[model samples]
Target chain A: MPNNIATVLSRQDTWRGRSQRLPRRTITTGHNNLDLLLQGGWPISVLTELMPQQSGIGELSLLLPTIKYYADNNQLCVWLDPPYQPYAPRLAAADIALDKLLVVRSKNHAEWLWAAEQSIRSGALLLAWTKQPPPRYADLRKLQLAAADNGNAAFLFSAPSAMSAPSPAALRLELQSLEINQLLLNVRKQRGVAGGAQLQLSLGEANTQRTNLALLPADRHRTYPVRQFNN
Target chain B: MLKRDIWLYLHFPLLPLEALLPQLPTEQAQKPIAIINLQKNIQRVLCCNTQAAAWGIEPDLSISTALALCPELELLSRQIEQEQQLLQQLALVAYSFSPVVILTDSGSLNHSSVPSNHSSGLWLEISGCYKLFKGYDALLRELDYRLRSQSITAVNGIGQNPLAAKLLCGPDFETQLPDQTEIQRRLLNADLSLLEINRKQQQSFKQLGLNTVGDLLALPRSALSRRFNAELMLTIAQLNNEKPFNAPRFQPANSFRDLIQNPQGIFNKESLLFPMKTLLQHLCQYLMARQCHCREIEWHFEPLIGESQKMQIQLSGSQNNWSTLLMLSRLQLERLELPRSIEQIILYADQFIEAPMGVFNLDLFDNQKTAQQSCELIDSLNARLGIDALSQPILNQDYLPEQASTLATPGKHSNTSLNKKLKAPQPLWLLTDPAPVHLRNKKLYWRQPLTIISGPERLCGNWWQAEQQRDYYLACDSNGARYWLFRETSSQRWFVHGLFS
Candidate 1:
């Protein structure tokens, strides 16, 4: 028996152990600098966690471009229990196809989780965004497993308090507002790569403002013609 | 042209027993049990299980005597109304097999002159349905399988007409597939007691040495009619397929309504599930047979001691799946607190849509099928939660930032249709109501000092109702929180409207 086992092990093409490879397909973050910082872009067919430092910090704006890309390709984008009502004019300004967007608000946590699980398992080329409390390890694992076969992406928005706790998400990032029309992204965890990378992104043209005024030479106390906005 | 109609008769020998079997626990089913009914002062047994029969107990025996024979017997009083409801439910099962199903009881044959003993059963005309079901044999096999699946014990018989079919379904006719000639032979060999005739007429037939139907048929028709009566002559003609009698066919109603009366009343929420599931399953089959779907169902819970409460569930789309309906109802029931014990539950449905005939795709990889399944999931959630809980943002044709957009119902309309024509960039999150901000010495205050990035986008509207004017700006506070602020030109007051993020 030992000799037969040795013979089988000596075969030229016998598969062994687990495979270590990464998914090649990715979705760009619409910011070239941030995309480069993440090594291509956010990988598709995985769960990505986005933790905002506080409410209204350009968190939704960060994902709008990816959402619009999918919508233009005739794919669905679902939002489960958004904190505030999505304003239509801004979505249109971002070139998002509203017909492809679905918003579901559940009455309680269980219903919200059920809707989220079902959306990921639907197998559509889509993206699902959900704002929820910090879920337990088992629930996150379930979503992760469901996303593996989803052939798309899912973004989970949670409070920054979840940073200290462990998670099963493929990628985890904290989005912070550094100044007006500028955001800082801190990657806390990611699959197939080391974490702890800070990247800066500039806002869109509408968010940027330019004003001209009379100017003076340097070292001379004077109000010169300058572009006045957040650094 | 007299058509030869083939009829199949189904006799449920144990419907009374089977109807109450589901209510019993598994351990109690193997024991001797008998259902008793009181007639004038004597408690007579209406039906008994095989275990009771083995203990020398049978139908029509006095309850006391049966108890004396089997000291450990279990007894339950018979509810006649429940038996009638079970008969109606059985008729629905028969309707699935043939379009023309007739429910037969003792007095259903009211036109007959004779007083024949007839048990309750179902009759179906299968001449036209044979080709669709491959053959009569295959159809019978399928019918038998379905009956046994429900734990019902039935006896079946086939004949050229309904009369012959019913008479041939005796206690010994468990599964008989007789042809036309075979049916004639069986009917002739049957005893004359099978006919519904007066006692005097039956005595005379026996006194004349006539034993079987064949013995009476051998005599001259006119002489027999003279000996018997005109009704007997008609019966004979009908049995032989010479006279065609239209058995009133049972037609399904356009809407569904059912009431389940549990005399003991449902004590807890768990007990209500049993009766609700039964009603839902029957309703699903009823709708499926008609190729229709219902959009809403109303449930009325009638308590024994209080005013009845009604709960209605509105579906996002038309549906007929029994399990899904059961699940949604379960969620609703779980959240309810009963005021008193519920004695009866009534379900009603009226709005229906014609369903297209198609095979359901069960494969998970089928994109359209999965999408449909997800839609159903959303509907189930909305049915439990109010429809207002789910919504999408849509563009409104107003100038005010607060009124320019609103949340519309999900899946009801295209949310993007109006947004495409808009030209302004609105904030993602708007305040529920504008909060007044303080501005002094050309400096904005929002819990801290704020700096203006740009702005003075002037707008005005709604002059017919209440005139409004404002200059909106984009600003941020020291904490890096961007806000949308507008100053009312009339009052010179500043208010926050939205957040950029």
Candidate 2:
């Protein structure tokens, strides 16, 4: 194939068409450890909702890793919330720099959604989030569309166990701390894989890795977490 | 090496998701679920399609209007926190398959983010995913399969870029790559309008004789940059997979507002409950933060000099979370005079203080549990069957059978029975209402009944509806049933009301 034809044709080929779908993408989550678990870092334009960490669970702890990852990737990581609260002190604990973090807090839920929807649609982040609950289908759908449109990943976190109902989400996770500092991450509901299991592990920060504790949920089997409700 | 980048767009119908919406009651989830954009307290439905059509509601319908169309609809409050969580879940699920997943909102997925009204969408760029998630087909299959479980309708479109992929999702339009080459040969041709070209921009482009990116590409890149901003340049760059960094706009700081809306124009008691509950909660929180007492009243009438300022508001009260606010709102509602068309309302208290009432320690935990259980039952029933479906018989002093019974409206008619002698520590499972039963020979007996429960105890309410208070009987039926059976004083009408489960 002639180089001239390939370049001009390729450029022309990408000329304004209604629909375009790239077949493959690299997943880059702003963290080395999580990327290992994900097989890739946060894939560009994918969505990841981080659960809150209670006690030592450190659910919000992962946000820093992902944010730092994005900052390293030269992508903007926005946090839409009360702004005053950021893991500045905690960043050093996770080997993260506070400058990589983008703080965004809206006056209300509507503004929050609006800002999130806009930010996610921009495709300019390793991650962006707000401490709000997505109680409506439209808001989720809108954010989903924005993520899809921008070809950028979006992360939305809700406080205090908000992922109760099945939403327009790809992976819904419920993270809690179990006995003796073991983290109980219930892939409560996921779109593609069966995730119903207790990803039990004790974090030894000194080593900076989550050692394999146990893949619980012997009776039921699936990839994505589907377990709901603690009986 | 920072490997070469690729972007993919996936589109899902917001409607087809019905089959996969998890275990939401048919009456609730199947009904048109409008994700609303609540502005200044007024909510507007954002997306509408065939799925919503099944519910007989259209896009742009007001929430109340949507309710009017589908009264049985299940409505989850519009909380962005929850919605974003859902989107994140979806994005993460897709992440498993595609390494690069760009999120996009359907509303703006095809529209111009740089030049348009700043629309939002989920435009996932799943590039370089061939090795990670098998292939595009596998990725799509997994995405569809998962979306179904969550009751989502997805429009799948595989294209070269997020914008192009989003445009490909719709079949009504022909999708393809603009320039022809072997790689572009497989691509479908699509109109530029599918990019959600702003009407104003589209007109401007047509006027300028630049119909498509192809036309714009024909111009020198330097001239193009000089003629127009990077908006056109960026979109062009995106089509070619040239990375475009979206530097977001600056958001200002300083937040927090303390205020309350009044509950005056609330005439229909049952209908007013939901709005009252929401507002009262907000008010209570406000008062608590201010540390004050609430005693007076103020109102912000609606249809203001500016219609958007919010209608006749219940303007007076302690903006604090307290049971008193609930009671005060109820009282104000009871005394309110409905205007020709009541709008927004505000409330303000004349005097209030840090009068934090002491918590009355109660030792009646056992009895209280049962009472709480009954209240929860009533609330759940109201939630399911609607408040209008509930009623109990209340008797009056009148001996006439016709004037002996009335409806025991829930949440109202607080005093059940006035006869102090009839007061006893009855089981909380007492039936608030009663049903008619056929007697064998003018004698009340449960021979054949649907449910048999508790409450032989008697009760009475406002006799305006109907009345006939008498000694009640707790009886069981032939089918292992339990019920509260009672006979009217003069009418001899046998009635049963509830079941204890």
Candidate 3:
């Protein structure tokens, strides 16, 4: 009986309890504690869903390090249907190569999905946001397959309400902010791992302040000479 | 020892009729058809299909006579423009086999029964290329197969000189050539009527008892020059390889333009894809032959009832592959809603760039492969969506958040450096226009009540233009959403500008 059990365990398709024999490839998430909570870092070649409770909650800041890593490696990073213009100076300040970054705005849901699928199939790190008439479950499955085939990471952002909906994403995280620059991440789904893992991360500038010298009374009323035009 | 040159002549006897046959309906194309031209104020038949000839209506017959012979004969006026275009297209096909291809319109030299604009030919210098195709037989076989696939009827001839090649191309001429002496013997027996000389010259030859080319060659050259015209002497010199036959080398068109007509009128937009694919394949062949790549292609669709519609498909990068181009064209066509049935489709591409050498490289580790894939994805997206749909974020050196960054077309590299001197962290998303914050009961309310976290970082610049002064802050709403807010010191009004996410 012991010999039979050993042979069965030696098979390549054998599933082991409490541990994964083939761990997924990952890229660091820039935060040590969050990386540790996710078991190494953000998974590669799979869909990772980030559902933030609201906008402006350090969600993009969390992925900044990974995006920077891809851009630095001369790989393309595509942003599809972002809600607002991605401030280039901020990304540039984060050391992301602007030339390697593509921002695609699709006119309709179908175009958006097509662009997302094409981006994933091209092996580019895709970061897409769900808009009106959100993608169906089948669309996400297609994207997951594309990501798996291309061996690239694709991150999808949706409203926090999507946390309860079924998703094909390999990793699903519910994001909320405890305070300014402080993000709380609850792992809702993870393949081959237990769910309900949570971590808190301090994201942007923690303690930095600059005096409002430009708004002082003397500068408030500063005036400049107007240029004269000849007729 | 110097090797002699070998020339191949392809004579298209019914080019005028064949060029216009593709534009006709299936039923109309099968009936008796004849191409007629005005000769001395008389409508004379230039060329006719076998169906017409079966009714005893042959070339040089008057139109009235032709009508009498075959009352159902369909007479079409000779189209000089179409014939020229078809000749050029054939020259391009011949160019694929040999580098030196010469296009000739032998309408004037043809028999009086088949006058000018009725026949055309392409001469290919094949001595250097036959070996590349393995042998002369294989080369000729391949050429014949290509022409046959296009429904082109050509008379093929081979000779040591261009004139001999043309003269040897008879209705009963054999493709297989014997020794040089046999070829000479055949050339000697060729009738004087086969020569390009006019009727007057032919009569002069017959009056002098020179019926065969050998009979004329037997006469003294000085005597023949004194008796015959300069044109006859020139023809003799060219046939004997004494004078060089120098015509312009065929240059493939810099741009690709081809037209396809559907008399049945394609009603469904999807049906247009089949014909569009064929045109794209031809365009790819043209590009490959020229070693060039095109970035834009204009598709003009002429409908039966409405004005012609034009759709342009522009690629982010120059591409010459048929599959890629066809895919892009398909994407573009899917979005086009045709108002009427399409009668004709003209594909034109003028902008061409030399294809890079690395484009054909199959090296696994070639870094350009990834870049090319990225460009292809961008092109595919842009084709389905508008060109403005895709862009790259570029940073600018300025103080204002809106002025510090801008959107540029994809693939544009930015060289501007961010102002790192600002210590405060910048927001990830910025609104095109700031939203005003409501102050109720002395509390900042933007969707909800806001609580200031830490800011008051002043970003005051552009004083020379609009003279602006504002105090910026980092604030959080009741839902824990961080907002980049600012208060105009002059107006004492507050607005939200960006999101920290």
Candidate 4:
């Protein structure tokens, strides 16, 4: 072989032997207000549990801004199993484009994992949602590897009353409805930070006015609508 | 001839006769034990050497004749199919060395251009393998080492043609390459036998002085063709590498496998996160063809040679995604002890909630995107929080839009909407189970003194209750915010429930 071609081949081999590494970035929920309230936007490297209000509260509304942020940023926000139709009209009313949301409907248990794996491996997807239980160690490791390999985010959506399973997430959360217009969001457990302090909030009115009248007195309400910022 | 045009044919006996010798009965390792294949009960001649002389068996001899010569001879069933598979495996392994590796039919090899280990059992056509592999010698050593590691043994031969290499590299060659002149001279000499055609032809050839390979070749080409049949010319062409040998074609089965380096990422860690999205994409494609969606996915991971540990989750509404299930699993998986290194991940999306019921083909221009947007919005919140956290209120049976403003699960249209009281557009705010504030002298200071601008628009119901004869009023506060208040004459208590501005 000619020296030049040999040299080129050698260089190519050397280059390929060590793949070009992509930079790992930290995930930040786009809503500046909510992001400030969360621990670097819901623990970038862990799973944060979501507790819905059994008595109808602001669960959906609270996460809208964040979901919208991801969708706008070219990140895929997947909702594996959702109770209500993310009525595109309602979501559009909230100003979210349906195209940015990848709605997946899983048929069985096996497929849930398969889909999770697929989403995790896509590298370009910003988020994947599933209603399945937490992953086992191997898949969790795969997820962590994926997190390290690709700078994407993944999330699991399950019921509040669901039984506990293993966790590979950095944080855990439990939410409850405090009053008609007040929601109680609590961090049950967090990996890196110790987070348990109720931060209060009221459902911001549609007209953008303060509706302190709707918020029950903190002392009066048994379950206070709170944000566990310390976590 | 161009050097590049020199095609070297190579073949290797996967189950070398030497390797099988000791496994056989007695010290037959030294016996001339050749492994022959039988097709339709007819034993076809295969490979043999001086070792079989002890048993008095030779190549081309039928099994019955060999058995008669040696009473203790062992007979084995031929496994051509198994041998073919094994050889194909060997070929695949060999292909890794060079893309140019081709199966040779003559059971021999030619690699005269490169010097390689005689015991390596690998024949390298350096010209082609050199480019793919770093060097011709490197390729030979690699193939040799790989084959040895696989525990397959063979005799290596390198030459320029099938006949030359096979005839030279046998046990008879003393493990040395044959000289080109000696090989060519022998081949030429053998050609003289071609004159021994049919009985009458043989007699004529003998009379004409043709007896050996060299003598047969000495005849002019045109004269030989006219005098003998086409087989005579074909034999010579094969000897001179002029004939082509088609190789056996084969295909392999398809299999899907994944190597999960860290399965704990989905379990032990909370704050549902996926480090890899590529895996998700692959998984999506795999499941897409099955026409299914994952509702509840669980992960069961097994380390190499270890027991499987799986985490299961229940979802209020099942979703098909990596993050949702992972997140659910993350919280539940915090305390699990992971194996040293996970070999595989088994994911179970057990909760199979069928696809949501919605319009697949809505008027494309209907532009009812708001509903979908709300649905998506509700889904996300439900993901991080529980399902009950979100709701849009429905009025009670009071025929009141104000009551309808009470928070209810977002989409369900319960009997609350059926109430005749909620016929008109209502004020945004509505209080449930109205609270009472004593009105001093029928003048109440509720949310700024309603200037008493609007009169009591009275329509009384529930009068049957022995409680009170209630009077209703649409009172306007000085601030233009109208209030809907009711009075209980018996208790003389006034309550504010909604507004009209």
lDDT: which candidate is best?
3
TM-score of 3: 0.86
RMSD of 4: 18.2
Best by DockQ: 3
Chain A TM-scores of all predicted models: 0.76, 0.65, 0.80, 0.64
- The pairs that clash in candidate 3 are B107-B116
Query: What C-alpha lDDT values do all the predictions have?
Result: 0.73, 0.45, 0.80, 0.46
Sliding window of 10 residues with minimal summed lDDT for model 1 chain B: B110-119
Ranking 1 against 4 by lDDT, winner: 1
- Model 4 per-residue lDDT at A220: 22
Query: Which candidate would rank higher by TM-score, 1 or 2?
Result: 1
Better of 1 and 2 by DockQ: 1
Question: Candidate 4, DockQ to 2 decimals?
Answer: 0.05
For residues A12-92, write the lDDT of model 4, one tens digit per residue.
Answer: 112344445211123343233334445335443334445553312445555565566555544445555454334332344
TM-score of each: 0.80, 0.29, 0.86, 0.42
CAPRI quality level assigned to candidate 4 from its DockQ score: incorrect
lDDT of 1 by residue, B1-501 (tens): 655688888888777677777666667888999987675567788789999999999888887899899999999877555666677777888888898788775324654422122265889888888678888788888888888887788888777878878877766434436666777798889888977777998999989999898898788888988788887898888877778756677767778888777656778888898889988988887887677888889899999888898878777657888888888888777667764788889899888888745634455454445545555655665666557766667766778877877777766664334524434445788876888888777798866677887788887877664438888888888757788888888888898888888
Model 2 gets an lDDT of 0.45
Candidate 3 residue runs with Cα over 4 Å from true position = A1-23, A28-40, A72-75, A205-231, B38-45, B48-74, B106-117, B130-132, B170-186, B207-215, B363-366, B411-422, B440-443, B477-481
TM-score of chain B of 1: 0.82
The 10-residue segment of model 4 chain B with minimum total lDDT is B113-122
Q: For candidate 2, what's the RMSD?
A: 30.8
